[model samples]
Target: MLFDCIPSHEIPELLHCDWLQSCDDEATVLGLLDIFTSLALESSAPDNSRPGVLAALIKHARVLAEYVQRCGPDAVTTRSFIQWILAKTVAELRMEPGFHNVGLDRWDRLVINQGESVHLPVFVPLKPSEKPSWRMFLTTSNTTQESAVKVAYRAALHTDDLSLQAMALKLLSLQLEDPREPLRTLSLLQMGMQGDIDGFLSTSLSRYLLVEHLSDARSLVQELSDLDNLSGGQSLLYSGVNPCLLWARDVILGHLLAVISGQKRAGNREWERNSSLHRFEFQT
Candidate 1:
C-alpha cells in the first residue's frame, strides 16, 4: 500500500524541522496524526485492485503500528483513527473471529480489523533473509467437540466425500423444486445427527467449511434430502453459521470475493447476474 516508500521517510522533522517544530502544539500533533492516517489509506488503494490494495493497506498499517507502538495508548487521536480503520477493514474483509478459521500458516499476515492492528504472528517468510523459525507456533481457535463435529461435517462436503456422493445425489432428488416433495431433508439431517452417522455428517460439513468445497456441501445437503431428514435448506444454506456465530457467511463470502477481485468491488461488470452477489450487504 505504501509502495516502496520507507517509513523512515516519514521522519519529516530533520530537514524541514522548522516548518512543524516552529509550531509544535497539540493541534499540530493531532493534525500530523490525521495526515498520517489518511496517507496510509490513500497509499494503500492501488489500481483499486486486490493484491495492490492489500499491499498498500498493509504498508499504511505498518506505519500506524509503528506510531501506536512508539506512543503507546496516549496517542488516542491517532489510535482512535487506526481503530476505526481497523474495524472497517475487518468488516470489509469478513475477518471476524470464528467467522472462518484463521490458519496457523497464514496467521502472521497483518489483517486490519476494527482499527486495531491485529499483531498476528506473521507466518510466511517474504524474503530469504527473513525466514520464519521452526519454533512451533500454537493457535487457539478450534471449537468444542460438538462444534468440531459440525466443522468436520462441513469439511467432508467441501472436499467431496466419496462415500456420501450417492447419498447426496439421492438427497438432491428431493429438492427438485417440485410441488410434491415434502420438506424431508431436515428429518434426514436429524437422523444422521441422532444415529451413528455423526461421523459422516460431521466430517462432511467440516470439510465444506475448512476447504470451502460447496459441491461437497451440496452433496451433503442432497444426502440429507434423499433420506428425508431435512426440513429445509435454509439451515444448510448457512451451514457454517448460526445466530450464535459472531459473523455470518454472507458477509464473509462478500469479503472473500472482494479480496479475490482486488477491491471492495460489489458486482461483476462483465457478468451482470454475478454482479448481484458481488455486494456483501447482509444483516447480522
Candidate 2:
C-alpha cells in the first residue's frame, strides 16, 4: 500500500527496493502488477511521468512472469498480464524517443520463450509510402534494419535452441540485401560467426561474394582457414576432410576464375587482378 501513497513519478523507484526484489509470494507480485497497471491506465497521470511508470510496469511484469514460471500455479495468468503490459506500452510509447532502449532484453526473452503468442506491435514507418515492419519500432536511427539485426544477433548468441537459431539466421539473411554497407556486412558476419560454419557459413560467404563484398568475404575465409590451421587441421571444419571447407574453396576459386576471365567487370582493374591472383594462390 506504500506504493499508493507515492507519486506516479516515484513508482518506478520502488521496483529497485531490496525487499521487493526478494519477495516471492505470488499475491504480492500480482498485487504489485495490478497497482502498476492502474498507474499505467490512469489518464490523469502527468504526461512527463507516464514513460517511467510504464517502463516500471513492463519490467516488473516481465520479472513476475519469470517468477511465476519458476514458482507456479499462476504462470498462465502472469503471462497474460505481461502480454497486456507489453501491448499497452508499445501502443503508448512507440513514437517516443529512447523507446527502443527500454525493456528490449525482456522482450527478446519473452519472444524466444513464448514465440508469437507475445504480440509485438509493428513499427509505424515514418514515410507514408513505407510499409510497417515487425521490430522496426526498435530502430535507433534512420537506418531501419539495425534493430532487427541486433535482435537476431542477440537471439542467435543467447540460445542453443536449433529452431530459434535457424529463425534468427533466416531473419538475418533477409537483411543481406540491404544497400547499407554496415548493415549487410554485419548480417553476413553475424550469420557466419554465430554457429558452426558448416554449410550455413559457406552460404553466408557465398552471399558476401554475390553482394561483391569481396574484402569481407576474403577476410572470413582467411579467418576460417587460420582457425583450422591453428587447431592442427583437426578443427570441426577440417575433420574427416569436411565438405564445407572444400565447398568454400571451390566457391572462392570460382569467383577468382570469373574475375581473371573477365566475366565480372573489375571495379579497380589492377586491384581486382592482384586480389584475384592472391586468392587463387591461397585457395590452391
Candidate 3:
C-alpha cells in the first residue's frame, strides 16, 4: 500500500517529492488523490483543527496534482487530475471562508506613498474559452493588501463571459475588508450594467453603492420602510423591490443615465463608444 511506503512524519516532505511515480499506475495515482481529498475533508471534523490541517491538505493536493501531471502513466489520467485540481481548489476556496489565506501572492516591495505610482505586472485578458485557474491561483497571495485588486484585475482581464467576470468582480468587492476603492467598484458595476450580466444583489456591492449613492439608497430604504409599515411585513409581492436590490438598480441606472447624457468619462473613449444609448437599451 502507499501508506506502508510513507510514514506520517514524512507526509510533509512527501509533498515536495515525486513520490507518485512509486505507485507506477494511473489508477493508484487517482486513488491517492481521492484519499488525500477525503483526508483533507476529514480534517474539518473539529473547528480548531481546521486551519493548519486544511492548509496542509491544500498544499498536499497541489503537490499530488503536480506529481500526476509529471508522472501519471497515461494522458487521460493526467488531464483528469488537472481538471480535478482546478475544481477541487475552487470548491475548497469557496466553502472554507477561513481558507482565503491560501493562494495569496507574496508582496516583495515596500510602498511608502502608495497610489498609481506603484509598479504592477499586467497580464493580458484571457479568452472566453480559456480557464483562468492558474492566474486565479497566482492571485491568491495575501502578502499585499491589494490582493483583492489583484484578483479583480485578473478577472477583468477576462473578456470572454460578462456574467462570470461580473460575479468575480462582485466577490472581489465583497472580499475587500480595508479601505474601499470606489473607482474600481464602480467600474465593475458599470461593466455588469452595460452587458448581459444579471444576478441577485451582492451585499458588498449594495453597501458600497449605498454609501456612495447616499440620497438614492436612503430614499429607497425609506420607501421600503413605508411599505413594511403599510403591509406589516406581510408583503411578499413587491416583485423584487427589496432595499438591497433597489440600491443596486439605482446605482446601475445612475451610471447608465450618466453615459446617455453624454457625460464622457476621461480616458474612457472605448466605454463612451460602446455605451451608446441604443447598445445600452439592447443589453438591458
Candidate 4:
C-alpha cells in the first residue's frame, strides 16, 4: 500500500495529497484509516512524532466524516469511524506527557501556540474574528474539537455501545470543563434542550462543583429555571404527572448549599472517582 511506503513521521503530510482528497472509494478510505490507526498505536515512534500523528488522525477523521455523511447518516460505518476517532483522540490525550499536570487550559494554549510550528492547521480558525483571544481552540469554529464533539455526540445518541457512549460523555465533559463563557453555557443548554437532561446536569454540575465554579453554577441554575418557565414546565423532564424540574433544580441547589455550608462534601470526591474510572486526569 502507498501508506506502507511512507515513513510514520511523514504520515501527516499525506493529508495534503491531491489524489487522496479526490479518492472516493469507501474501502480505500477505511483501509487508510485502519493503517493510520495501527501506526498511531506504535509506541516505538519518537515522542516528537506523537503530536503530528494525532493531528493527522484528527484531520483525516474530519475528512472521512464529511465523506461518510454524504453517503448517509447514522450508518454503521459512520458510527465505527466516529468511535475510532474518539478512541484515538482519547488515547493520544492519555499518552501526552504532563497532560495531567499541565491542565487543559495550559495544554490548550500550548496546542494553539505550537499549532503553526507543528503544521496543525486544524487548530487555526477560518475567520480570525470567529474566535477571540479568550476562547480556546476546542470551542473555535470548524476546528477538530467542534467536529469531534459533533460526531461523538451523534454517535452517543445513536449507538448502543456502552463504551462508545462513555467516550462521548468523557469528550463532552472535557469540553465542559473549559472555563470560557457563552460557548460553554450554550453547549450545556443545548444538551438539556436536546433531551440529554441527565448528561447536561451531571456533567455541568459535577465539573462546576469539582472546580468550585460557584458563579457558573449559579448561572446554570438560573438558566435552567428560565428554561423550565419558558417551556411552561413541560420540558423534557416532564414525568407524566409532574416535571422533574424540581428534582433537577433541587439537586443543583443542594450542591450549591453544600458548598456554601463550609462542610466538606463528596461531590468533588465522587467526581474524582468517576474521572479516574474514565482515565481522565484533567485538573481544573
Question: Which candidate ranks first by TM-score, i.e. highest?
Answer: 4
Candidate 1 is scored at a TM of: 0.22
Question: Per-residue lDDT for 254 in model 3?
Answer: 43
Better of 1 and 2 by lDDT: 2
lDDT of 1 by residue, 47-158 (tens): 2233343344444444444544455454532433433243234223332233233243543221112122221112212111222221222122223322332333344355
lDDT on C-alpha atoms for all candidate structures: 0.33, 0.41, 0.38, 0.44
RMSD of each: 20.1, 17.6, 17.1, 13.6
Q: Per-residue CA lDDT of candidate 3, range 1-284, in tens?
A: 67577655356446435555465465665666655654554453322234555566556666566667676346323333533433243334445445332332232111111112111111111111111222221223232323433443454444343433443454344344422453245444543454211122222223322333446435434433343343456642354333323333333344433434445432333233433421322111
User: Candidate 2: worst 10 consecutive residues by lDDT?
Assistant: 109-118
All candidates: TM-score: 0.22, 0.30, 0.29, 0.35
Report how far residue 174 has shifted in candidate 3, in Å. 4.1
Superposed Cα deviation of residue 208, candidate 1 (Å): 14
What is the clash count of model 4? 0
Candidate 4 lDDT over residue span 67-161, tens digit each:
65566654434545666566455545545553332223423111112111111101211211121222221211224654675576666566544
Over 4 Å off, model 2 = 1-166, 179-195, 211-227, 234-245, 257-284
Best by lDDT: 4
